[model samples]
Target: MQLISLCSGSLAALGAVLFAYGNGLSKWGGLAVLLLGTAVLLLSLSLQRRQEKEVTRLHRQIMDFLAGKNKTPKFSVNDDLFAVLENSVVELESRLLLERENTRKSSKRNADFITDVSHQLKTPLAALKLYCEMDQARNLGAHSQKQLALIERMEHLIYSLLRLEKLRADVYELQFAKHDLSRLLEQVWEELKVLYPEKKFTIIGTAELRCDAYWLHEAVKNVIKNACEHTTAAGHIQVLLETSETVVTLSIEDDGGGIAETELPKLFQRFYRTAQTKASGGAGIGLAITKTIVEKHHGTIAAENTAHGLRIVMCFPILDGVLAAG
Candidate 1:
């Protein structure tokens, strides 16, 4: 429309100039031409502004639709392209919402199944443990002793599985508070020390963060215990704490030969054990539980092979309010 208006105005100006020239009115013709050009420029500017406003309106509508702020967008009947785009966006949003709902239902079903199975097994497992205890009390033979040990291990595995599923399903409540990280690490080390007295454990620094002390202890203990299992007797396991304005990082490094590079990504997966770890009798739920706990605290955990051995790092964000309080 703007282009046609400009072309028509140019032709009119040309005709007026020729008429004025023939009638000896060149000055009037010049003024008429200037007026025509000005009108055409104003019209074009008006058309451009209207087009821009239409585009801005369409963009906002699309954004609102996608954000679920608006369920139905007002479509422009005059603009076929804009209408088509709006329909496409609405379709995409519908598909995304459906997929999300399906995923949520599936996760809930899986969590419920795990919870039910864990509950069912607990009763029989308790009975089995009791029976084994009774046999041991009667001075059962070595074979019975081994069976009792296996049963205990199985009980532990079942408990760990339930805990992992609860954490993953967000049913586990974490009590968050500002706690001294150094003291927490010390507490974990104290318990681990009794289990693996041959391994050397050290805490090198201090920090304080808002976290669930109990769950965080569980996470840290699991990592350190895994480190102990992988390391040689008398190997050094160092826990380093470092804090910055934005993050607090806790690193556990051990002199155990690091995991294979190919298996690094699978470390946090439930029941995923490398050949070496499988031989060590790990059910592989520890790291998975640790990852869930860290994520629940809005933190990140990663494992990497260091020059000396393996380093598992957990980094927690320092909230603005916490920084201010500090």
Candidate 2:
């Protein structure tokens, strides 16, 4: 194409010179040459326009394929220059298909493992619980009571671990809906009253929020349980629920011995127990599960040490179109 353009330009320039200086026959021949040059120039431009259109179409096709708007890609140009790019697209598609297959297999394996573990543990835990109850009925000494407590703790730890794993892996489907914060707090407080009959609990304020009610209740219960576990009989626990235009916040405060400043950040991490917590038979996964539950609902959970004790706060975004609290 470049060669054609150069030859045509040269012929047009030569024709101009001949038309300027030559006789009648030479002048007519020069005019024909100039006309031919102009025709060839127009033809070259037409071909260039055709190539540009092809390129634009190919770009759009590739983009659509990458964006998942198209499953199959068709390329019209068989030019050698495009072969490498075409081959790359085909290879990428093949690799993605393989990755999807591998992911499906991995997910199936994890599901099977979780089911098997849960089933195997259930039978033993049931038997242990029965035996613990029988020993208590027989009026066995404090050693028997301690053994039963240990067994119960083991059961709790196993269940918590299973739940934590499923939540962290996104295997559990959460059911999210609007739930009244005041009522949910009342339910959690009732459970806490039974769990820690000695400790005092107070609810300070209320707000309405949207979340998976069951899961959010469990998350709050764990936070309150942690507070009760740490707080002394002389201390009290307080819960404050507040909402703004964009967010809802739940704060759980305890008057127990506060955690060390350095250990505050690690409190919500999986299997992380402070020395004080470890001494008190903490499994270290309750707060971790609480954190996961809060975050799964597009929220944040944090903890800090207060003058009286440890304080934990959870914040969740208000759903769109919901009225903010006054």
Candidate 3:
């Protein structure tokens, strides 16, 4: 750069000398030299700005890195322009390692809590399910049947709560692997069909979707089961799928009574239930679990009401894979 600047100055001075002698076009020559000097200055400044920006960008990325410490894996940015980025990344990673240690301790506590609760609940729940299946169950009337059904619902609630708490402690347990989405959805549908024998379900797309097979399966199953629990016996549930180069969307719609409009926003929060059916079996964590699993895969889930009933929509990115759109 210095050599270029010196060369430009020499040309300008030389142009001045030529004009002083008797070249009539010396004025144009000098102006051309001045423009060349300006260009050199601009180039040097632009390079400086780019180098500075690379440093600032790395600094800003660190803030996001720290913010995502618990939720995302650690990352590093190594650039030749900002050699300090490597050191900073290493230090930040050491700090993240400490953070992970703290998280592990907290996770152990939560796991212990869940384990105790499950152990305590398991004994009675097992006895209840056993008693309900006994000869005494044969003699029970409709009112008694309702009581037994409530017990079964409570049993499911206990199991789901335990499952969520365990997963919540170290959510990374949700595995990701290549699997056919169509087959998984079929399995969830078959299970829900038998569970809700009176309802009808239809799958609407022909293309195969690839994603975290088991987690997606659980998410879809929970959503469908939640819909089935709310739906009437004669209602219909439709699974409409849309795919593109980048994403796959699965919309599960039911024809039961829709939820209150005001309650829609809180649907995915743990332990929150709609007033219309608080007596239903769920502890309100089903949707929350579904949301967590989807988000871990960098996907999204949303709930809406159709003219007839409720619908849950899930979208998964087609990561590192390609498929035909439908």
Our tally of clashes for model 3 stands at 0
Model 3 ranges off by over 4 Å: 1-81, 84-104, 127-151, 196-198, 206-210, 244-246, 321-326
- Model 1 spans > 4 angstroms off: 1-107, 139-142, 320-326
Model 2 earns a TM-score of: 0.60
RMSD of each: 9.1, 11.8, 7.6
What TM-score, over all chains together, does every model reach?
0.65, 0.60, 0.63
**Tens digit of per-residue lDDT, candidate 2, span 145-227:** 88788888878887887888777666777766688898998899987787788888888888888788898999999888888
Model 2 regions more than 4 Å off: 1-115, 124-145, 321-326
Best by TM-score: 1
Provide the clashing-pair count of each candidate structure.
Answer: 0, 0, 0
Tens digits of per-residue lDDT, candidate 3, 1-326, equal 45665675666566556556645567677666656666766676676677678768766655545444333434445556355655667576677768777976896788778779888988987787677667356876556566677778777877787777666566445444566666787899887777788788788884455556776788888888877877777778889888898887889898877898889889999888897558674578889888877776667888888789888888887754221110
lDDT, residue 242, model 3: 83
lDDT of each: 0.81, 0.79, 0.72
Residue 75, candidate 2: C-alpha displacement in angstroms: 18
Clashing pairs in 3: none
